[model samples]
Target: MKYNEFLPITLEEMKARGWERADFIVITGDAYIDHPSFGAAVISRTLESAGYKVGIISQPNWRNVGDFKKLGKPKYGFLITAGNIDSMVNHYTVSKRRREKDYYSPGGKMGLRPDRASIVYCNMVKQAYKGVPIIIGGIEASLRRFAHYDYWSDKVRRSILFDSEADLLVFGMGEHQILEIAESLKNGLDIQYMHHIAGTCYKSDTKENLYHFIELPSYETIATDKIAYARAFKIQYEEQDAVRGKVLVQPHGNSYIVQNPPAMPLSEVELDRIYSLPYARKVHPIYEKDGGVPAIEEVKHSIISSRGCFGSCSFCALTFHQGRVIQSRSHTSILEEAEKIVKSEDFKGYIHDVGGPTANFRNIACEKQKKEGTCKNKQCLYPHPCRNLNVDHGEYLDLLRKLRKIKGVKKVFVRSGLRYDYIISDPKDTFLKELCEHHISGQLKVAPEHISPKVLDLMGKPRREVYDKFVDKYYKINQSLGKEQYLVPYLMSSHPGSDLKAAVEMAEYLRDIRYYPEQVQDFYPTPGTLSTCMFYTGLDPRNMKPVYVPKDRDEKAMQRALLQFKNPKNYELVKKALILAGRKDLIGFGPKALIKPLGKERQNIREVKYSNKKPATKNRNSSKNTKKR
Candidate 1:
């Protein structure tokens, strides 16, 4: 098969492929982009590689069953996903306001998919064809496999398995899980009875067959009680590993949502096959008239060198979705992809990226993780690097060196989130030096998140000292190389444990650094993150200690304003925050003052400066929850 041979989307195409009906129809909430970066595309292509006829139904109109029926019923079932991102996150902003652009949609248009898209599509599929097996996967379903707190609804909702009509929910990467389920179905086994598959959740009536599992608080209890919710989240977070992870059963009213132990990470050769599939590497040509997918621009030239993160930031859902074990592609596979990219007509000499979930995590954190999986209790890098952590970036460094040597590739950038602490732990400066010389252009972006110890601890990030160490080392390396590269540190605001005082402390750090961020990542409490769990429950799931959560709208805005306190528009909010924190001393005309003394003349001057300019357009497509961070 060639790149031009896209999978069957329309029935005529299915007939052209000489198939009476598809064995499985993938219904996604995104415009069909047949690229490996897309989760839907990968799953569909993997099925096709296994000799299964897979059809795609991308972003069918929820109001009309006819749009879904267009693909017709499948022989096996329908594999549904809400695209690459969670539906609610794609639809709304941190403030619960509707976002104007959907990066995953055609031409960055919004409303291409409905909110709670997986459930909505399942309902529509049922209306279109009853009694057909419905299997739900993707970020939306994976993260919501348990009874999670829905940020959009501001209520604890039943597990997506219970709410949706999906017979099975593939919670992690579905390559293995989907194949197993498809084989079982092909052998005439019923979907309901196939609950033994790893990395999947199925609803069960009785607990008779559920053995060696831990039962969580019922959905009703966690919905009302915060403590119970925290407790449940703690248990769920701990048992996400493939090895030594037991079966987890959570009661949802009368039924139970049983999640088996996570599936094992694929080996290098197996992972290579996933990217080796004949992906068309473009948005389906049908959408060309609407302008190509805005999301593709960021990643079209990028290569995924690795998957999953052991960095284990509390605000990230990688733990729940991808697990902590890092799975990477072989260097040979990546080089092959680079050659193909170089051959493209649009090749710009620069390869956009050569990394993944965490760019530096090309291998396991330690040799122990290979067989035992990630430590259930200890983090690989947090307050400090684990004594057992094998912090070597040599393999990743070599991969980059090879890519940069590619004939047509001018530069290879590592544009993904990298753990500075990991770089700090490495004894050698070779990788850091090479990175400065070849990888970056003008500046490198890193997430310091906050400067407060208390907040950093809650976020599972290294202490401020570690970031300081990195900053010194980064600049020193650049200086030695005669390069003047800068660091664009990513910061977040209003996370749990970020009281007004802590927010003020972060402001003081910004003043010292002399960096004013244009965009501030205010903690968006999406489901399946420890930080989100803390936001909803006001208790740390790890310790059950009370965490001060800034829930008030005014306080949240004040915290955000404090980050960019240098902005003239934030004067009022900054003044209010400083006063509330009893740091009224900061509200004066001293050198340390965040804002100038409030006066009618000064205010008028500021207002004129602000109002004279055109309104700054927000890149609604550039969401803070982006995987890049």
Candidate 2:
């Protein structure tokens, strides 16, 4: 049962296994940690289970071909990834400065991976292996499978398949796609014929015959015209569903990049089998001396109960990657994993988390989704909850109950965010009560993003009133249970449709609520999201309405400062912002004032207030008598 001794990482290890060549070579930008939480570990293990000899090349040097040749050459092909996060996102912060630490690297190191790792690694592999097929996946490849705006480059970039020159690109949850690709290669199918597979993108010549496919605006057109780019993005967004989606093609130079419909959501039985694979559940021993991989600690004891999301927030990439469908593991499968966690030496009777993308979601949005796929043009939990949305948390609550009852388990927390709007819409309040009583660890985090209706609509979030009702109900339930808990809202600044006036209004709302967040998220324009489209084109892709975006660094800083106005460091920025908005009335001393005046002005106000006050009692005895009375 202990099948996870880890796959071969060196020539000696491969020779020891009596293999001259591996069926697959997985090249990754992360240290080799054989935990299920890691994508490389799962894919390699899944292939091994399917009778393919797989090898790993983790954090290989891109300066030369020597590192790429360590695994020799795979017989089937090379699977390349930029680790768990997009290479650019991993390497930089929101401010576009290089990060000092990479959790995916050994010893929390930096610079182990190159920028745009999937493209770089694939090129390296191609140089070393000659004509052997190359396949790229993970966040970097998935989000870039089409023409998208690149924040780092400050312009639109072509599909990664074109840039990496890989034979095929796998996007989204790739387990099923990996299996199908392997089977086709095993049957001696040509890589060119593999274009029809779902969840894949490949390059084709113009002479190739095409049928029943939607042609997006040519890459050349989008690259030059912002409006054309937004229009292209809109077409891609509408056809992401598996059941109703169409084959989409976009021309690039002489060749066209064809993307098949998304892969079908894995059924419960399939998801259970995937999660039940032999994962070592920790960082591999090869990384021990270098202080081990830092990313393993967070997920070592947690369970990924489900995958995908239907609460399609505009800023989120889940729809583009995971698709707007929910697929979850069976309760028995989750409990089995929990039992394994309980037996671990490091587990001290606590399970860090027990959920996925959206914690409480256990099934698809509605019954129609099971047969028809998700609605192509409408969302389930955005704008407003759909009439047919089947909102029930009973099964999820039951699973949590079972987890808590397992032996040696003291507590289980739902650290993944709850979709507040979804919870508030359910007529039955049973799930809400159970969530408050059992799952919370004194504080629950939720994403309301912004309070402005304009911004909220742009975010594909429910109106502010929906979140308000949820908060009120949450406290009401907690009070009845005799527990004191708080809701920590995730707020964003400088998103599209958020102007200086809106930012000031947000600050005023924060003042009213008495909540000053320690951290605020600046709108990050990552690829393949509606918000990113607006950030790039200055027009909402869905409606083609013009939107205001705070692109200047100073303007963005002012917006962020208003969110944390109580911090002394943000004082000057907040003062300047108030003046800019022509709200000087908020600058002086008053019950509603956001900040105080400096030095002489403050002292003069104090003196005026003191002089206007009634005189103090002259006699100490009379004062004492009054106090006694």
- Maximum-lDDT candidate: 1
- The model with the greatest TM-score is 2
lDDT by residue (tens digit), candidate 2, 99-157 = 99999999999999999999899889888978898989988999999988899989888
Please give the lDDT score at residue 31 for candidate 1.
Answer: 93
Q: How much lDDT does candidate 1 score?
A: 0.91
Q: How close is every model to the real structure, measured as TM-score?
A: 0.95, 0.95
Give the TM-score comparing model 2 with the true structure, all chains together. Answer: 0.95
Off by over 4 Å in 1: 1-4, 600-629
Steric clash pairs (candidate 2)? none
Worst 10 residues of 2 by lDDT: 617-626
The reply for model 2, stretches above 4 Å from the true place, is: 1-4, 600-629
Q: Cα deviation of 175 in candidate 2 (Å)?
A: 1.5
Model 1 poorest ten-residue lDDT run? 617-626
Per-residue alpha-carbon lDDT of candidate 1 for residues 1-629, written as tens digits (9 for 90 to 100): 34246888899898887889999999999999998999999999999899999999999989989889887889999999999999989988899999999998888999889999999999998888989999999999999999999887789999998788689999888899999999999999999799889999999999997788999999999999999999999999999999889999888878899999999998999899999999988888888889978988988899998899998899999999998998999999999999999997798999999889999999888899887878988998876899998889999998998998999888888899888999999999998899889999999999999989999999999999999999999999999999999999999999999999999999998988898999999999988999999999999999999999999999999999999999999988999999899997887556787877766845665556545655542244235323332
